[model samples]
Target: MLVRIVKMSFEPSKIEEFLANFETVKTKIRSFEGCNFLELYRDQNNTNIFFTYSYWNAEEDLENYRHSELFKSVWSKTKPLFNAKPEAWSVDKIASLK
Candidate 1:
């Protein structure tokens, strides 16, 4: 499985817009091909900072999703809300308790 983590920092004024957009698109994203799981997290100390954690069947599946129309649509609405360039990582899970 491939674990994908994306850290996004949004302009404070745009946080609600980002969250609303995520709410509308998250289910579609989670149901996309090869997607095993999806979650959203917010930084306790910094409300504008958020992270997306997801599991995919493989890197190829992830790449496919990234290139899909769903992604482009979601990203177009999301890109302008960011206060900083997002950071992402695709990694193999090394260990997990549950």
Candidate 2:
């Protein structure tokens, strides 16, 4: 499995907007082809910082989603809310307990 993690820091004023947008699209994202799981996390000490942790069948599947119209639409709205450049990582699962 491929593990994808994205770290995003948003402008304080845009956090609610981002959460609302995510609510509207989370299901779509989770159901995308080869997507095994999806989740959003917030930094405990930094409320404006968030992360997305997901599992994909493969890198190709993730790429396909990234290039899809769904991604384009979501990103168009999301990119502007950022206070810092977003960071992402794609890695192989080394082990898991559940």
Candidate 3:
């Protein structure tokens, strides 16, 4: 499995609009091929900052989604709300004792 996290900082006034757009397409995203699970988060101390934590089948799977039209439309709407460049990370899972 692959783990991905993205941190985005949004303009104060644009957060709500950004969230609205995300809501519109979130269902489609959650059902996309290769997706395992997905979630969203907001920084408690930094109200304008948000993050998305997701699991994918593989790096290429996530890449396919990134290059899809669904991503294009969602990103185009979300990008305009940014206060700074978004950051993302991809990681491989490690074995657990359980």
User: How far off is residue 18 in model 3, in Å?
Assistant: 1.0
lDDT of 2 by residue, 1-98 (tens): 89999999999999999999999999999999999999999999999999999999999999999999999999999999999999999988887796
Candidate 3 structure quality by residue, lDDT tens digits, 1-98: 99999999999999999888888888899899999889999999999999999999999999999999999999989998899999999987787586
Worst 10 residues of 1 by lDDT: 89-98
- lDDT, residue 9, candidate 2: 100
Model 1: per-residue Cα lDDT over 29-85, one tens digit each: 999999999999999999999999999999999999999999999999999999999
Two-way TM-score contest, 1 vs 3, winner: 1
- Runs of candidate 1 exceeding 4 Å displacement: none
Q: List TM-scores for all candidates, in order.
A: 0.98, 0.98, 0.94
State the C-alpha lDDT per candidate: 0.98, 0.98, 0.93
Given candidate 1, what's the lDDT at residue 74?
A: 99
Clashing residue pair totals per candidate (backbone < 3 A) = 0, 0, 0
Q: Against the true structure, candidate 3 has what lDDT?
A: 0.93
Score candidate 3 by TM-score against the native: 0.94
